[model samples]
Target: MTRYTPALATALAVLLPVSATADSFTATIAAGHPPVFRWIRMISDTFIPTVTAELEKSGHTITFDEQYGGALAKVGEELEAVEAGLAELGTCQSLFDPAKLAVQNVTYYTPFVSADLRKVGEVIDSLHADLPAMTEAYGENGVVYIGAPITIDDYLLMTNFPVESLADLDGRKIAAPGAAINWLSGTGAVGVAGNLTTYYNEIKTGVYDGVLVFASAALPGKLYEVAPYVTRAGLGAQYAGSLCANADWYEGLPDDVKAALKTGADAARDWYTTELETAVGVSLEKMAEAGATVTNAPDAMRAAWAKGMENAAAKWAAELDAQGKPATEVLTTYMEAMRAAGATPLRDWDKE
Candidate 1:
């Protein structure tokens, strides 16, 4: 038991009248890939800084726990991790998580459409904001879109041997990511499900003869050392993933904090697309200088390659539509948007 005096009581009264204001927030940002990738790098370089700056204007601060290289989540598992609250936010790779994000893979199913990374990134980001259907999967997974769209540059075939024609791919073990594997149909090539992380070693060790990869990644991965023949077959740029936050965690944030996150994401998107646009040309040039033989497929060969493949888009849309996913609608909308933006697709995936 203790005695309470007037001075002690006054001191306690003065010290205990604290306000219940939250001036800070803590977030854990996860990515399956390491910071070597431009998209991952932008998280640290652009997204975090932009968010911090915006929050500071309103007398708020945020602390971010950056997790990359599968330290927190592996590729295709980020969405689940965020949904389960293992992380507050992550890059939800729709391209890899095709079953969960079927509608998000519309671009992959409809290849040979556009190679413009800027256009694809802008259009896809717009869709995410303007189209409720675009974000339906996120809601189902207990996550919400936070932007920072990842637009892969034009995909090219990098093989150990020269590919002057489609016949060169016959019987060869070629690797592609996710839905893009379907592009191998009617090409006579064996399409192995592979990713950028294992492409260099797999190809070098004879596990794969070649890979359908993009230049921006090929240069950093040094795939030229293994598969030196790079053929620009015009598979087109792709919307692989985007930033997502745990629905509960995001909703709990203050309005200003949420606005800051959006601002950060928009800044990151602009930075990423500009960097990717520059990287495509620079990566190809560097790979060529490093002894990789680079060639563009002939017009006839490109046309034949596109014509030979099965209508994967129609099949994919039909399958998802049967499952009650708005894949067909998303596909049609994407194609219309692309066409309206001046893209001349080799095949009308939605119309046909």
Candidate 2:
């Protein structure tokens, strides 16, 4: 080959480096919930910022377009939106899509495990990594499961009337989110499927006498104004949502870019967990300050409630098992992992 002139070589070198440098990418992340929700807020506050910083270290950068609070997808529509490429990433509320992402609702089925939110989240995320079926559910929906699962604090019974025992809930209507309604089985409470957004209005209007809600959400929704009696039932923490990315889009990313996104998700998990932990105490205090009656259900009542309930977890796993899904495997793995992590479950759904 003929040697290039000095000027030509200089131009070629400049062009070569420019071509070799990673191209910037733009990803749009969506969330159905508003920024007021800690999990959603962490997307902008921690995930985006952390991702930006991590990619910069590799000489690659990404510009994230945040669409939250139903701007792009309404509640329960995030998975479809991401799969259809409406959003490159989003918060997929598995609780809202139990029909499609059935195994992801394990914690909701197995209650009274533990109130340690961080442990619950960590265990579920680990399952997603360790189990093929866990991630396969997302792959089947054309989404990639990011490791950070959104976990909520312990569930409690918020009511207009005092609830010291399971007897207090007899014939009472209680609003509960999907899958969680099963928690009311054998407790004599009529479970009505409801969500946080409508809890206040429904309770105020007497559509339901009470709601199965967590403190972190109740304070923001101002549910105390309507259901002033709060009973800490210790119904257990839950993993209800996760950050996911469009499978095609995620697979097409450069390795470094992909790593950055995962790093961001990991960081967001810690941030969200810390924020949620802090918020729980603050929310309960705020509710109590707002003239709400907050009391802990006695140990006897908590035990009675657990024993009285139908084994929804076992039934749920068996149904999925019949469908040829590894539901029992996942259930066993999850319950074992929880116990290994120092959780003393009220009932071992997998074994029982």
TM-scores for every candidate against the unseen true structure:
0.91, 0.93
lDDT of 1: 0.92
* Regions more than 4 Å wrong, model 1: 1-22
lDDT of 2 by residue, 76-191 (tens): 89999999999999999988877778898899999999999999999998898888978878988999997668999999899999987889899999999888899998899999
Give the per-residue lDDT of model 1 (tens digit) for 65-172: 999999999988999999999999999999878888879988999889999988898889898898888999999999999999999999999999999999988999
Runs in model 2 with CA error above 4 Å?
1-20
Top candidate (TM-score): 2
Each model's C-alpha lDDT? 0.92, 0.91
Model 2 TM-score on a 0 to 1 scale: 0.93
- Clashes per prediction? 0, 0
Error of 1 at 170 (Å): 2.7
The collision pairs in model 2 are none
